[model samples]
Target chain A: MSAVGGGFGRCDAPRATARLEALTPFDRAGRRATESHASSRQLAGRTATITQDTSANPGDLFYLDLHTHSTDGSDDAGATVEGYLRWITGRRRFGYRIDGFVLTEHRRFDADRDYTALAEQYGVTVLRGIEVETDVGHVLVYGVAPGFYRDFDVTNVSLPYEDVFRAAREHGGIAVGAHAGRPRIGLAEHVDRRSVSVEGVGIVEALNGGSSDEENSHALHFAEEHGLKAVGGSDSHFVSGIARCLTAFPEPVHSVEALVEALLSHEYRPVAVEETHDDEEIRERSRRLQAVRSTAEAVHHEGGEVEYDHSVIGVEVEIGSAEITHEQIAAYCESTGDTNPLYRDEAAAEAGPFGGLVAPPGLLSALVQGRGPDPKVQYGNTTFMSGQRMEYVAPVRPGDTITGYASVKEVYEKTGRSGRMVFVVNRTRYANQRGEDVSANESSMVHRQVAPRKES
Target chain B: MSDAITQRYFEDVWPGDEYIEEHQPTGDDVAEYLHINQMGRRAQTGNLDGRFTDVAGAARQGLARPIVPGAMSMALITRLVTDWMGPLGHLRSIEVSFRRPVQHDDRLRANALVTDASDEDGEPTATLDVFFENERGERPVQGTAVVVLPRRTQPAPVVE
Candidate 1:
């Protein structure tokens, strides 16, 4: 139910508006349910009528970042598809214009993963491309087809540039040289020093976000002399660097096929994110986004310093255990007023299911109270339990010994209305005497700095 | 544990289907929960001094009135799910976040909404958004639950 392939270009006016109006409530609810696990395909089916207004002038340019990487499809990338969408949503909320971004993950294209639902949720157009290495350097490919995959080994570090370029065009795709001015990996350097001639190459990346100023200048000049059109890409492996450099198209582009047509037909130009976005907001938000990367990294806030002991993460330790006895089961039932005969009267329970007495599932909460390694999160002076998650695999029967193993699952910081807060998640796994997992739980604790109260 | 309650099948549910149950926990209910949990003896309690059960104890922790114990709230939620799932349905996991306090004697509405249903990996399961709401329209406790329910086409697992 998204505008992925339909929103771009001028369509029937009155009909599109009517369909959009009918789909508005569903789309809004979908967005509000942030944790809704509705798959992209389901969302696409649900919001098929969601579309951008045709009220805009057809002459208006649509801006898109042509190159980016995400952790889902690239090993070297640190940003997730959702993370990029969140950061982009943050920028768009401030009235900045960033139409969309292309996830040109290095060496692979996940054709099965559809991001149409995410795009509709974030109100940002999401598309996919691939960045591949060749004999001349790295190439950015868009609108890839099944034939393109059969023609080239994208993982190869020395793919023939001419054939890759020819095959890309033959398969209804377009290829552009990536980071064209960098040494060893740039087509500009190879062309200048080794006289490497890449035929039918009409585009090269001129403003790669990761490249130096001198390198970009060299690329810009190389494109001018070669009569090749220039595009810009962030080449970002991190979420904050997304859309640092962008390409402006003279027409709407809502899909990879449309993107290819726009790039080939329109005379596009490169634009930097700083040209339109507020520089300070970018810096502050980027800082906040990057701060959540690792526990070893720290971010200062007005309330206090936020950091944690990262060493305890993933390190497991024995948190002790307890053997479930019939007496213990009876006590648990008595405490909770759960007079179910299965847990209280052992002989009568034998005539019923479970063969004998069994402890209530909630007994795991009381039994696994052993202490584990503290993350020592350094944030607010006040700390409290935020929540608890328990996964029960099997019932606890009498005489079964249950052991708990604990570890620090994760630690991170978030800024909320109350002020800056740090969350530490500790996880514990409970196993029976037979070494079968009985259950697992994660306890989340929030640490916040409470200001001193004024005397009444 | 009872034969009177019919089993709920995975196919019989859909996202947004809601289940509601209300409870008004009195002072005695709170007291029983405290004694059952042993208030402090079992674990390192941070209630200042009986804050969860006594007003004087709660006042010391800046609370005007005694609040319902977190474990009691979790137990209520678990019971809500168990009652709905029936004997054939299994409660795989439940996670709860306590946003605000539920005061003693306050009528609490426990709600469970099926958020998603899937048979991925051949194990039919349903995800639910569970919460406790006071009359003030505040969700004092909210979380998610994942459960495995019997499929009508498949025979129920035998309890030996």
Candidate 2:
């Protein structure tokens, strides 16, 4: 048995190998047609090059762009299904063999669009997928079929994020948090890593084309901390943005179903840029694509971008609750060296002022510390816990759960020795499951943009 | 009550100790699970020949008829070991591969054998190699689980 997770490499399934040997052979690159339901063409096409997994691990493998947008259904995309295939074919000239891309249209899966001819001609795979805007953030849903489009009103963006993930689970698909490191639409931005860690979302976008380097770094860190699977997606709405980020699966996956399995099994690695041609070309293309998007609005549905403005104040919402474990409390006390007998000993706590094994002050702050209800303030890329004040209302005894609710009580600008800092003042109320207010905290987060590497 | 397992402790378990358990999943149970979980989202619902699961839909897609959803089988297998672990047993990890399908009304048996006993993060943990098999003895699910068990002689501090 594996000690924990990770360190499991792919093996050449001997049965699969024997079956492949029984089929007719095709010329390398699958240019020549062979017998066996055109099956040999697929297996022989890439199986010989399995060791070239993006992570450079010798294993059964394939590569594909996990995120792409199309004008057929999305208002923000520049390309048709065929337009993308043509572009993918063009990339082959640059010696980048892109196997395929999942067309993540905003709010809809465009189940009717047929790309068989285009896919075959360009030797690329084009699968339909949905990019949903949930209450928390945007998630990418793959393997959405025709019935799903009609039944779920796939065009609707009002579905709650948790519902979207549950639906994806039911349907045998996964709802991966898209561009999780970015602001507003990203999962890591609004929801704390602790919440996202326990939730059904098992995958996150560690590398995204539109997000900055630091934003992607935040996503990578979040994924590592939570042991969540990290994928790199282009999030492309245009030609140049395609394949900006890719996932290399250990085994050659022929369809989107296989891709989903690879993601869930943690059998893939994120790959960014096989070859760096130029950024100016991509930026120019993005500008041109925006123009195309503007024109294509007539043919497609619009509106799916979440931007947080720090303009609102006194906005209260629920920050949800986390179930605490005995071990977690121990870890916290270990870090802070809180030896308060009243906090640890039940006998002492019973004698103390109206308390039975009350939680220490650090636990309350830790419960309230992570990002509260998103103040939607985007002052900088890095979020730092600047300061906090805790007022102990009651005690959270053992066997009690803590639920947190927060409001953006204040938002103000400050300029100290360290440049202009945006302080988002939040008031969080922590309550035990027993309807007792445990602690109330007012905290400030200093959001300051990190200096660029060259500038520093 | 027929398969009631004796409560076990960290010190009581030895490698290669085997246990067997069984569960029968019906179509109605699946319907309730789907409906209660609100899992009837577009991806996994529809054509209920009595709340037919994704396994039922798989037949139309050229797969076996009325095969059980992988998650459903996983839930069953997880319960098999968890029931034995009692309240103090904290399930750490369950890693399984779906080698085949388990259809509705297929009474399945979970076979578990203790693989190792060691300390993880200062806690006593046991690893078990678990497998689920049908009446035909064909294994559909097989994996390993790591669980932290409470010490029988000593008590842990209350820190909840």
Candidate 3:
């Protein structure tokens, strides 16, 4: 309560005098009596009263990290549930307060298997959720029961998108279209007149970490066109990745219920990417390379004809010479809500046939950008992300600042119901600090040029 | 008159009615309502002192100033009917739609009119029209209710 009190202050001389003059003796007496009541009673009454306040106040602002992962699932640096909780609560202990966090693992893991139990053990409010990687797009379903994910078969269930969206809503959670415009099987490909007909969904991710300028812009345009609340995330995989794109509201989020209400009411604003970091240039260049690499990768994988230096290119390319440290991988996994220990569990990785820690396929793409893109230019887009098609040619261990270089292998154009689209093929070569090609990625993206109609 | 009665019901009643119950909502009520309902605070939590100051200002604007939840009004209507009809009577149906914004510090009344009564399976069923209006003669919620009443000879259950 530094300069910010519990949203109250003593009136200045004139206002105080006016208020005193306006009060009758009975009113003054009653006020005194009320003030003289016990402190506990006052606190209880205040708590009850604040619940009904409909106007913005300084005390009403609350913060939550809706997406987080542990090392219990796939594609992570092997940080345990407790380790993740310690990292998060440690921030609060050091004075950065967060209301709560949603543990959203990928489709392969169940939140209840380890995360929820550990959260309960730590006395933290953790919502059980899943970040489903559909063939068409990525969707984050929050506040859902543990068994719900199982009901929707990750492999075989061709459940209508509406059914999945409705199920998430019925269980007292929200279904957000995550990273809508990224190169893979994104929401733009899955969503149409049929998908839009599903009601009760009002949120969309307008920004994601590692997103390209074009992809982000597409996301923003989509959110605006559909009249939805735009959300943003770092899609971080590490502790440093927290707050990449924070949602700010007025404060004192007393419970998870209030937090949900805040989101549903659209009483929040997405913290732009540019506003997130201190270093502008580092983020900007990193973002550009991310776009270029992802674009080029998409082209080669889509079977498009791209004649480039494939012999010189390795399986994966590290953009800048940053060590592929164990710490970096672990942090990346945590921030992005990945919980698989194969990356973090050195013992497990060695015991397995791979004989060493292997990075998740998605991590291959994410790690290429390293820290994140320039935050300023990062604003304005709603994000829709898809799973990556990564091949682990070799083991990537700790203390490896893998240098990655990517080339646009080819470019093509196609026409769909959406409109004219351009596809870019990207091939990336990865090497250790020694500059040896360790892994490679061939990815493709189909960019739609036509802008979506704005909805009022 | 019967048509009006048919259109409204006792169970569907709220506060702020014109011909039945009359009372003026105050600044304190508005503040209490907002605080309890968690409606307008932009911040995550509520502020007690701010509520006190703002609620008073809202009252001066002639609105319900601190309009309580419609559920609260429904509860009050239920209490009123329960008291008049006795404990053996069961509230069967209640339907209400908020027509206009109800603000803080507005004088309000709750009203009801019995329109239909019939005997079915030895039980008496009554239909009543209900309404809620402010001192300014505006209806905020209006609807109807159906209730099943026990025989007059049967004593209502007593709890010690």
Candidate 4:
């Protein structure tokens, strides 16, 4: 609710919500009213009907990123629901008021995977929607209901756009053409060349974060000429890109039902997140990333010979031992956010095949000693753990005394794109009090030679 | 109590099956993990390169915050596999490659895709491709895991 300029102002919430329902759809009366609005809104000459009243109350305009993807549902999306929330919270510090974002995952909707708890924790309203491929282009469907899926196979890559548009309205949702100016998929190209006209299609994404300025311009003009209403979305597959463009509504939207109702009100507009003067946070993040990368790069510098004690390659020695306890097992689960009942719930464990609470396979790192006999490899200026392989022979339970025996498995040199590097492989075996081997681990470390300095 | 303790039989699984679980590590969680692994001593010894303990240390290394240890990242993936396999399945082997640093407070999703499931050499086993994907959609940690599970019908016990 922060000010972007003198243009936005907060109004009484109860009055705005009441007025919005009168202007939207829900019950019999609202639907009848909306049918008229929907029909008039669809006309290609309804441009003059759009309200440009400066006297309209701003209310609490909810700014929501209408399109986003997440790894939980979208295969190509890199952002998580929580990641977006955290980034949004960070943005709020800079006075950018991003109320929420919709998860418009590609091709599917997991109705059971709810984000209510996460939304409450972050104080951000989370809603679910879907983006499906069609003959015309990709379409963003908000407020998807179960009945909609029954009518259309949304997973179909080549769904008929005409049916999708009608079906969305029938199911209490809205379908907006996504990235409307992009090539091949956008509605603009189809309308211009193929004379493709989608009846009942009303809204198109006018400001997509992923779309180029020229592409967005094309979509804006397309909407103007077609007399289509518009919404905005980030179309963001990543965290930072979220809310770059969003739909600003006149009333607060807390659910899919409210979102649909508000869109039908035709009082919302696409708005970009205005940049603030105190955006040092974003700059600092990139700076840190650069630092981490450069530090890593310096370790991969070229030109050095590998040296190590050859005799210690196969020498085995006892490293250390620790008694596994139930308390330790519980603490490990808590630290890792592991909610597996078999590890924490004794009653559940007793009913299972194990017949008792067993430590997680990962707990071996804590039980087994970290340091083993050094391979004494003298090579590079940088050393790091490259990889680890572990084999569990048996389950380790509480009251088991675990002991680790270690040895230098091997030391070898390899050349990669980076340069010459020496790798030391260390092997460790964990045993119970009865001296039975429970697991074995092989960890490899890489030593990279320092790069030769440049002549300045 | 978690609802993930259900039993999974060897015969019920298939190749190409995928399981995803999310884990968000707080700064305290990372600190405790390093402490439990006895790596906290590095913090006391002034060896902090801003890797996994504090913010000031992270800033010195050009990091916005402390990072989760690679070992902890591996542990999270292990939990993902175990949670999916349930109590009946036994984890036989896991090999992981630490591809990138996972910063503290980063939300991660562990993904496991079953590559092969078969009864080989009288033992039923499943091979899975597992990875830890950060919010940035990058697989910072990934590898393969082999698990052993009990068949629904046991073969006749050795009569020797």
> Between candidates 3 and 4, which one is better according to lDDT?
4
lDDT of 2 by residue, A1-456 (tens): 001111001111111110213322321211111111111111111000101223332223465788888768754354457656654554443334467888887776545678877888888877767787655567888764454445575544445667778778677777788877655457775566225333777888877765545456667777776788888778765454567667777677667787777777867766654422122232122110011100000111123323356545666666656555555555444333233444555675664443465554445444433334566765565544444444555546656777777788776543321234467767888888886777776655666554322111
Residue range A1-456, candidate 3, lDDT tens digits: 001111001111110000112211222101110011011111100000001122223124454556555445534312244544544443333223344555566555453364456676665655545666543356777666555665676422123456667777776766777766554434543444224342545787666543444565566666666787866654434332343344556654434455556677757765432222223331222222112112211211122222323343233332454456666566554432233445677775565334567554334444453221111211112211111223345556676666667655544433222223344445666777666667665444444332222221
Give per-residue CA lDDT, model 1, range B9-108, as digits (tens). Answer: 7766654344555667766777766665553235455343655677766655445577777777787777667655655567888878766667887766
Candidate 4, residues A1-456, lDDT tens digits: the string is: 011111001111111010112322221111111111111111110011112232223234678889888878864454568767866764564345688989998788988898999999999999999998777778999896799988887666567889998899988898899877655457766677668895678899877766645556667778878998887888765555577778888778999999988878878887665421123332121111111101112121223345688888878888777888888887787676666766878897776657777888888776566456776888765565667888988778899988888899888654322335577888989999999999999877777553433222
Residue ranges of candidate 3 with Cα displaced over 4 Å: A1-60, A76-78, A89-97, A108-111, A114-125, A155-159, A189-200, A249-260, A272-456, B1-160
Give each model a TM-score: 0.50, 0.37, 0.35, 0.48
Compared with the true structure, all predictions reach lDDT values of 0.65, 0.54, 0.43, 0.65
User: What local lDDT score does residue B146 receive in model 3, on the 0 to 100 scale?
Assistant: 54
> How big is the positional error of residue A101 in model 1, measured in Å on the Cα after superposition?
19
Q: Which portions of model 4 show Cα errors greater than 4 Å?
A: A1-300, A415-420, A449-456, B39-50, B55-65, B151-160
Output the lDDT of residue A142, model 4.
88
- Write down the TM-score of model 1's second chain: 0.88
lDDT tens per residue, model 2, B32-101: 4444323212232343332246543544433344555554455455545554554345555554545445
Please state the i-RMS of candidate 1.
12.5
Clashing residue pairs for model 4: A288-B62, B50-B57
Model 1: what is its DockQ? 0.12
Query: Model 3 residue A272 lDDT?
Result: 34
